[model samples]
Target: MNSSDSLKLVVKQQNLEDISHYIYAIVYPIVFLLGIVGNLLSSLLFSVTKLNRTSCGVYFLLLAVFDTIALIGGLHHCLNIGYRVAIPNATYCRARVFLVYVSMDMTSWMIVAISVDRYLKVKYPITARIYATQKLAMIVSSIIMIIFIVKNVHLATVFIGDFSSNAADNCDANPLYPKYVAFFHNVWPWIDLTTYALFPFLIVTICNAFIIHDQYKRRVKLRKRNLDRSLITLLLVSSISLILCNLPITILAGVYTHISTSTNTND
Candidate 1:
């Protein structure tokens, strides 16, 4: 394209991104409110429901708790990135990013734990009894949370709020590693995309597939009746949702890696 055309293209792209940012600002606040309220109600319901007294219910309840935290982080992200509401507070900037990632990581891993617990319970009913207890679910969720918090602790230091700088007023983590910032931005997101998103997606899919197959066998080969298809359906739906929700961010990470780092002009 010619220079004029190129300039128009860049401006158009920027306009679209701005439009998307504004849209996100509007939508995410609603998302944040609904998420908090819905998760709270669900958490209470799970805690009271007799079905949640089981190992599976415990996992679901913990997932709800993690999701609630993530939703709070989501509000921070929407306000800060979309509207610059939290950009002035350095502590909030740092803490919000850390909490966002850590909570999201735990959320994904908890689903993994849930899927595995269900798979084992169906695959090895007797052996799974001791392994898939509420206590075990709690321990696993806690460990996963701890591991992610430790892994992402560097976020707090990296994300600084320095209004003195001429960089945009948005809450972006400055490039601490100046020369390597582009490379870092390009690669680090993928590491998260892999460990937190892709890995959990693959694990959940495999576990749920096995669970479904086992359920089918029990129904067809063994002449079993009264199968609880609801649980299986829930697992399938969750697996699909994880992939669908995360794939876009993972793709955007790559897109940002390419565009933001090409000239070291953005973060």
Candidate 2:
């Protein structure tokens, strides 16, 4: 590469980094505040209403908690990337990264639980009422949390505080653990894509489809619909929103991982 070409490339990279920092700086705080307020309102609503008495309510209440934790984890990362605040220690770095992944995984599976709950309610109302108790929801949620914690514990050991001069380099894979680092970069993203996006998307889609079909059948029969239409509507909307929001990122991540793997192989 010529000197002029190298200079231009350097400037371009710098500009891109600046843009990323600027975006994060502007976006993260706003998102954090809004997310906090939203979750709080949701919790309050669940508490005040009879919703808390049901399995779906249990899922939602826990969802708010998980979302709040995920948001906090994101803000920690944003501070490092957008405001030049460094992670203070290795332990903090590991904990922060671990919590972020675990919380996110929890959130994803919690949604799946909610979808399943809704499916049972819609498809087999009598059976659901008999089996899908609030106690069961709590047990299921706890199981999901524990599973994700175990699944993501490796994140705690694999990540270390990046002591680099650049603040944007907050936490990175520990070089001493080559196998783990390779897994983190080369394998983990795909696993995350499946767990975080693809799997949830699939479950939600199938559940929503059944719910929709059941609703249609009810309408056709002109039977007084026993299921709560509003809740069903809400489920449909949330499922669609999740699919739309997650699909692009999931596809992009998959493609990017493939390209990166190919590049690393070539090198």
TM-score of each: 0.81, 0.82
Residue 258 of model 1, lDDT score? 33
Clashing pairs in 2: none
List candidate 1 stretches off by more than 4 Å.
81-86, 158-176, 179-183, 223-235, 252-267
Using alpha carbons, what is the TM-score of model 2? 0.82
Candidate achieving the largest lDDT: 2
* Model 2 CA deviation exceeding 4 Å by range: 1-12, 158-168, 223-236, 244-267
Clashes of each: 0, 0
Q: Model 2 misses residue 239 by how many Å?
A: 2.6
Candidate 1 residues 1-267, lDDT tens each? 899999998887677566646755898888788888888987988898785767888878888898998887666446544654435566766777688778788888888887888788889999898777777777877788788988888768753433332333333446665644553455678788997889999999999888877787778776776567797778779899999987776676455433322212333
**What 10-residue stretch in candidate 2 is worst by lDDT?**
258-267
